[model samples]
Target: MIPLLVCDDSAMARKQLIRALPAEWPVSITQATQGEEALAAIRQGLGRVVLLDLTMPVMDGYQVLAQLRAEGLSCKVVVVSGDVQEEAMRRVQELGALGFIKKPAPAEEVRATLQRLGLLDLEPPLAPTAPRPELALKVNFRDALREVSNVAMGRAAALLAQVLGTFVRLPIPQVNIFEVSELHMALLDAQRGQRLSAVCQGFIGDAIAGEALLLFHDLEIGAIANLLGWQPQNETETSEMLLDLASILTGACLSGIAEQIDVRFSQGHPQLLGQHSAIEQLIRLNRERWKNTLAVEISYSLEGHAVHFDLLLLFTEDSLSRLTKKIYYLMEQE
Candidate 1:
C-alpha cells in the first residue's frame, strides 16, 4: 500500500481530515506533529505523498518545502491549509506540490480526487443509475426518487390510520425538482389557496433528520371530509380537521421512508401551517436555512374520495444525492 503522511499542528484538524477520507482508501497513512517531524519522516523514505499544513511550529510548511525541493526530494506533496490566498496556493505549486486542498475540504470530494489521481484504489462499482426507458417518459432523476417516496408514504398512511382510528386518505406524492429561482413561482401557485394544511414530525436516521412538514392541500382536505361523512361548516373547521390529518399523514410518510431505508427515525410532533396565505407564511418561517428551496412535495388523497392534499418535503440541494442513493439502495434491496 502507498503510504501517505499527514502533517499538522492541530489534532482536531487531523481528526477532521481522517474522518472525511473514504473507508476504502488503500493507502496506509501516518501522521507527523510538525514540519520538523514531517521532514524527519521524509528522510526515512516512508511516505509517497506528504499532506503538509501551511502553519507549523519550529519549521513552517514553506521553509520545509523549500528545503525539501532544494535537496531534490521526489515525494509528491499536497498542501492542505486553511489559507486560501492566491499567493499561498501559487507558491505551493511553485514548490513542486502535486495538489492543493483547501482547509475543511468536503470529504467525498477529496476522496474522489485522490482516487482519480491513483493515490487510492478504486471503490466497488455502484449500482447502475436508472436508465431512460423505451417509452421516453419526461421525468428526471428526482422522479425516480419520488416513486421511492410513494411506496414509503403509502405504508406511512396505513400506520397512521391504525393509530388515529380514522380512515386516513393519502394522495400519490407529486415531486417537483426546481432550482431555488423557481421557488418564488412555486410559492405563487401554492399561495392561491393551493396550499394544504398539514401536521409535521421530524425523524432522524443516518444523517440527523431535518424538520418534516406534513400537510394536505385544499382539495385533499375537502375530499377527506367527504370520505369521513363530515360536512365542515367553514374553512376553519376544515383546517382543524387537517391537524389530525397531518399527524396521520406524517406518520405514514415517515414509516414508508424508514421501512425502505431499513432503519428507524426519531420523530417530532406535527405542527400547523394553516393560514389564509399559508404557503407564504410557511416559507417565511423557515427563511433562514430554507433561503433556497429544493423541495419534494407529496400529496395524499383520501381513498374513494375526491379530496386530495399536498405535503411539502423540502431539502437542500446538497442532501439530494444522499437522498437519491438511499432511495436507490432501498429499491435494490427489494
Candidate 2:
C-alpha cells in the first residue's frame, strides 16, 4: 500500500479529493490540514505522493513546494486547488509539481492524471474482497456552506484577476447565521473610519433566494480604476468603475454558488447602494425585512495593492433549510 498525504484546509475539499481518487488503488492515506503538517509528514516518509492545496492559513502550497525542494525531500506532488489563476499552476510546476487538478475534481480526470503519472494500472481491474466505504466526512451545515463559498470565491477571484490584470488573494470565507441586528458588527473592515461604497443585486431561482452585495473601500476606487485603465476623473466616472467591479465580482460569485447547487439565478441589475456610507446604515436599511439571515462573507485583496473589498451573500431564513438539503444531496452523490 502507498502512503499518500492529502493536504487541504477545508475538510470538504479533502473529502472530495479522496472521493475522486481511484477506488481500486491500494493506498494508506494521511490527512494534513496545512502545509506545515504536510511537511512534517513528508519528513517522516509518510507522503510518498502529496495532493496539495494552495490556499491555507498557516502555510500555503507554494511554501510547501519550496520547502520540499530546499530540504531535497523526495516525494511526488500534484496540486489540487480552487485558485485556478494561470500563475497558480505555473508556479507549482516550477516548484516541482507533477500537475494540477482544479476544484470540483472529477473522478475520471483524477484517474487519468494518475495513470499518466504511472501511479495507477487501470487497464486491468482488480476486484476487491469487500466494499470500501467513501471517506467518512461529518460535515456540518456551516462548514458545508463555507466550502461552497470557498469554491465560488475562487472563481470570482480568477475572473477579477483577469479583468484587473492582477492576482487576488483569497481568504477562507466567514459563514454565520446572524440576527438582522448583529449583521453589521460582522463587517469590521470599515472600523478604521474608512468610508465605503457598495452595490447590491437581488437574485432568485427555485427555492434559493438571496442578495449579493459588493462592499468597497472608498479609498481603493482610484487604485482599482487605475488598474483597469479607467482613471475616474469625476464622480460619475468613479461610480461607473464601481458598478463594473461589482458586476464582475458579484455576478461571478453568485453564479458559482448557483452552479454548485444545480440552480439558475436570475439576478437583478446591480444598484449602487450608497457612496461613503457606514456598513451599519447599509444593514439597518434592510434590517426590518429579515428576522434572520445566512451570511457568507468573502473578503478579497489585490496581490500588491491596498485594494480590498467584501463580497456578501445574504440568504433569507426560508432558504436556509433548502440550501442545507442541497448540500446534503451533493455530499451523498457518488
lDDT of each: 0.61, 0.84
- For residue 169, model 2's alpha carbon misses the true position, in angstroms, by 1.1
Candidate 1 residues lying further than 4 Å off, grouped into runs, are 1-144, 157-172, 191-198, 217-226, 229-240, 291-294, 331-334
Cand. 2 Cα-lDDT? 0.84
lDDT of 1 by residue, 1-334 (tens): 5567778765544555665565555455777868889888888876577888775668878887898988887687878775444556777889887777875556877776676666664334333334212112233445445554655554565554454334444333466656544765675665455645545555566663545665455555555676556788986777667766666666666666666556577777666756545556655665665555456675544434555455666765555566667755643332
In model 2, the worst 10-residue window by lDDT is 122-131
Give the per-residue lDDT digits (tens) of candidate 2, residues 72-149: 999999998888888777889999999888887889888888989887752454555343443886767677778888
lDDT of 1 at 201: 56
Best by lDDT: 2
Off by over 4 Å in 2: 121-126, 129-134, 188-191
